[model samples]
Target: MKEMTGLVNTKNKNKLPGDGVVGKTCNNVCNNKTFIYTRKSALTLLKTAGILLLVLVLLAAFTACVSRSNQEVGDTGTGTGTESSSGTGRETGGDQGDVQGAGSKDAGEFPLTVTDANGVEVKIEKKPQKIVSLTLSTDEMLLSLVDKGRIAAVSYLSVDPGQSNVAEEVKDLQKTGLEVESLIAMQPDLIIVADWSDQNAIKQLRDAKITVYALKTPSSINQVKDAVMTVAQLVGEKGKGQEIIQWMDGKLKAVEEKVKTLEDNQKLRVLSYNNFFCTHGIGTTFDDITKHAGVINLAAEQGMVMWQEISKEKIVELNPDAIFLPAWSYEGFDAEEFAGSLKNDKSLAGINAIKNNRVFCLPEAHLGTTSQNIVLGVEDMARAVYPGLFE
Candidate 1:
C-alpha cells in the first residue's frame, strides 16, 4: 500500500493575530516630565486599547483552531485507540487526513486510497454503496464483510455450491459475467477482481470510469489474511476483517496445539491429488496447510512449486502415507470414482495410502479456498491424517 499524504484543512480561512490591526501613535504631549491627556490623545489611546483587545481575541481563536485541527488529524492519521481482535494496534490507513468525502464513522475512513495488487494507486472517493465482485475469493470475503444489500453483483461461481462456501447466502444475488457491457450495466460504484482476471476487461471497466480493484491471489494462509484485510479495508470493514482473521487464528491454534502432541515418527506423509494427477507444492496454500496439519507434503518435499502434474511412476516411488482428493466433482470428473480408481490401481496398490484405505476426499470449497475458510482445510487435513489424536 502506498502512503497517504496531505493535510485536511476544515476551515476555509483563518486570520493571524494583529493581521488587520492598524498601527497608530498619539503625538500630543504637555511637557517632558508628564504626558498630557488631550481628547485627541485619549481617543488615540482608546483606539489602541481596542485594537490590542481584538488582537488578543484573534490570537485565542487562532490557538483554538490549531488545537482542534491537530486533534482531528491525530484521530484519523494515528488510528488511535483502535486495536485488532488479537490485541495489536491497528493501522487504519497511512496519512488519511487528506480524504475528502463522507464515510461511515463506525466502518472506516473514506475518500481512501490504496495500492492494488497490480501496483496501481487506486483512490476510492467514498464508501461504496454498490460493489461488484469478479472472483469467488472476493465474493466470499464480501459476503462475510458487508451487508448483502450493499452488493450489486458477484461472480457466477459464487452460486455454485461445489465451488463456493457461501453459495446459499449469495444464491439470490445477481450473478455477473466478465463481459464489459454486462459489468457496465450494473452501474457498480466499486468492482473487485483477481489479479488473473482479463486485463483487457479491467482496462475497459476503468476506461468506462468504473472503480476496480485487482487483488492478488493468495498462495499461502498469510497471503489469504492479507487479501481478506485488503478487501475489508477497501469496503470500510476493517473491524470485520480482523474478526475473520481472529476466528481463523483461533481454529488454527487449536489444531496446532493438538498437533504438538505428535512425535516426529508419528507425523504422516501426505499428498494432495486431483483427478488430473495435479498436486499443490511449495509456495502454494496446500503446502502451508500440510505444514500446519503436521504432515509432510511429498510434492513440496521434492522441491515442486505451485500446481504441477506428477508422473504415476513418481507417485509410486514417493509412496505417500495418505492421499487427499477433492470432494467436489465437475462436469466430466467424479471425485468418488477417482478415489475408487486410486484404490484399485494395480501399480498403486503397493502404496501405503491405498493399502491402508487412507484415501480421503476433502471438501473442494475448504481445500481450495482463498478466504478465511482455508483454516477449515487445515483442520480437516489434520483430522484425516491423525484421526486418533483428533478424536
Candidate 2:
C-alpha cells in the first residue's frame, strides 16, 4: 500500500497556517501522535517497492520516476494461429483486447530476443525461465502470465495479504526472506526488477550475466498495457499478457460508461489524501484515475500530483466539491481516518466539501495494485465519485 508522510506545503508558498483542514492517522509502522518526534534527514535511496504502486497506490505516499531504454523486440504475432504463440486474446475482452491462451511461456520455450526500449538491438541465447519479481504487482503480473514453477523467488513483502495477490504462493517464500544469495542460488535464467532504483541488486545479478529487465514506472493506462505485453513477450507469455490487458480495458469502459451517466452538474471536485495527511497531486497514477473518473481533482487544481506537503489552510482555499481519501494506512489504521479528519476539523468547516459531507472512501484493494484488477478500482472510483448512479 502507498505509505504517506506528513506534509507542510513546501511547494505552494502562498498557503499559510490554520489552513482549510486535515490530519491523517500515522502510517508509520510506529504510532505517531499529532506532533510526533520528527527527525529531518535526507532519505537515502532504497529499493523501489512497487515502483509506482508502492508509493501512489494509496494516499500517504508519492511515486518517484526516472527514464530508461530497455531492449525490445517488435510487437509481432499477426493474430494468426500459425504464429509461435497465437490466440492470446481474451474471449470476454479487455481494455486492449483478447485474454485467453496467454500463458505457457515455459523456460526455453523460445530463444531470448532482447529488445531495448529505444528499439536498440541486443541478442541473447535463451528467454528468462526462473524469474524474480521485485514488487507485489510484478509478482502478480508474472503469476498471471506464467505458472508458479517459473518464478524463482518473489519479493518478501508479497506475503502481506493486504498487498499481494498470490498470497498462497508467496506465503512459504516469505519465511525464506528475499536475499540476493538466495536468488543467485535459484539461478536459472533472468531477474525482473520493478524500478530502476533497484540498480544495485540488478548490477549484482548482471555480474553473473543473468538477463535483468529493468521496468520503468508507467504513468498512463496505455503504458500499463504495453508494459504487461512487453513482460509477457519476454516470458514467452504474450497470450497471458493479452488476457490481462483485456480485463483492464473491459473495466475501463465500464467505468467510463458509469461516469457518463452522472448528472452534468455533479462533476465532483475531489482530493486524494493518504494516511500521512499528504495529498496526491499531479503526475501520479491515482490522479490519472481521478481524471479518468470524470471528476475534477482538487490536488491537480493545486498542481500537486505526487504528494506536495500542504497545510489544511491550502485545502480550504481549494475548497473542492468532494474529497477522496484512499485508505492506504497499511499501518493498521482505518480507511476513514483521513476523511474523518477532514470532516471533523473545525477550521475545515470553511471548506465546501466538508460542509456538504462530500467525503467518501475508496476500496483499498482496487486502489492498491489492480494489475489484473484495475477495473475493480475504476468501478469503485466511479461509485464513490457518484454514489446513486451505480444502482
Report, for all candidates in order, the number of backbone clashes: 0, 36
Q: Candidate 2 on 332-363: residue-level lDDT in tens?
A: 67554555665788998977777776665544
Relative to the true structure, candidate 2 reaches a TM of 0.66
Q: Give the TM-score of candidate 1.
A: 0.75
Predicted candidate 1 versus true structure: per-residue lDDT over 246-272, tens digit per residue: 767877898899999888888899887
* Full-model lDDT for every candidate: 0.69, 0.54
**Candidate 2 lDDT (Cα, 0 to 1):** 0.54
Could you estimate the TM-score for every candidate? 0.75, 0.66
In terms of TM-score, which candidate is strongest?
A: 1
